[model samples]
Target: MENTKKKRYVLVSKTVLVERELWTRVRVAAAIEGETISGLVEKALCQYLERQAEKYGP
Candidate 1:
């Protein structure tokens, strides 16, 4: 039975096949940062982009 409850929003939807140990490490890192794995990855990527922009700024 599927619940008809509404969700807040759709963030990320993807599929990846990773090793159990690597998945565990990702989960632990997300927990320590108080974030979902998606959130952690998104934030990390955004920060990296900003740093790159600064380095290449006009």
Candidate 2:
């Protein structure tokens, strides 16, 4: 059977300042988890949004 799944792509660019200590912690966690910093940040943001949505609805 032919593949039915569709590829997805999302592109975003932004610049934000973070405390040095927090940045260091995120970098270390990403390295230990074998994930890119961007991925880690995106995962965190998604989870945060989910929590907010649960509390506020949609």
Candidate 3:
């Protein structure tokens, strides 16, 4: 049998302030997409970081 190890990540809570209009839009989009605001934000952030890393250095 082969052994495998799973990678673990730690998630931490964070507070972010956004404009009222943008926040409302995000809320509506999240509901329509069936995704949480936190999840949407996390995905966007990760994509942004990946682009930046590719452009610059990881």
Best by lDDT: 2
Q: How accurate is candidate 2 locally (lDDT)?
A: 0.80
Clashes of each: 0, 0, 0
lDDT of 2 by residue, 1-58 (tens): 9999754433334557665666778889999989999999889999999999999997
As a whole number from 0 to 100, the lDDT of residue 50 in candidate 1 is 96
* lDDT per residue as tens, model 1, 1-58: 9999654433234565565666677779999999999898789899999999999994
Against the hidden reference, what TM-scores do the models get? 0.55, 0.72, 0.65
**Residue 51's lDDT in candidate 3:** 97
Error of 3 at 39 (Å): 0.7
Lowest summed lDDT across 10 adjacent residues in model 2 is found at 6-15
Model 2 pairs in collision? none
**TM-score, prediction 1:** 0.55
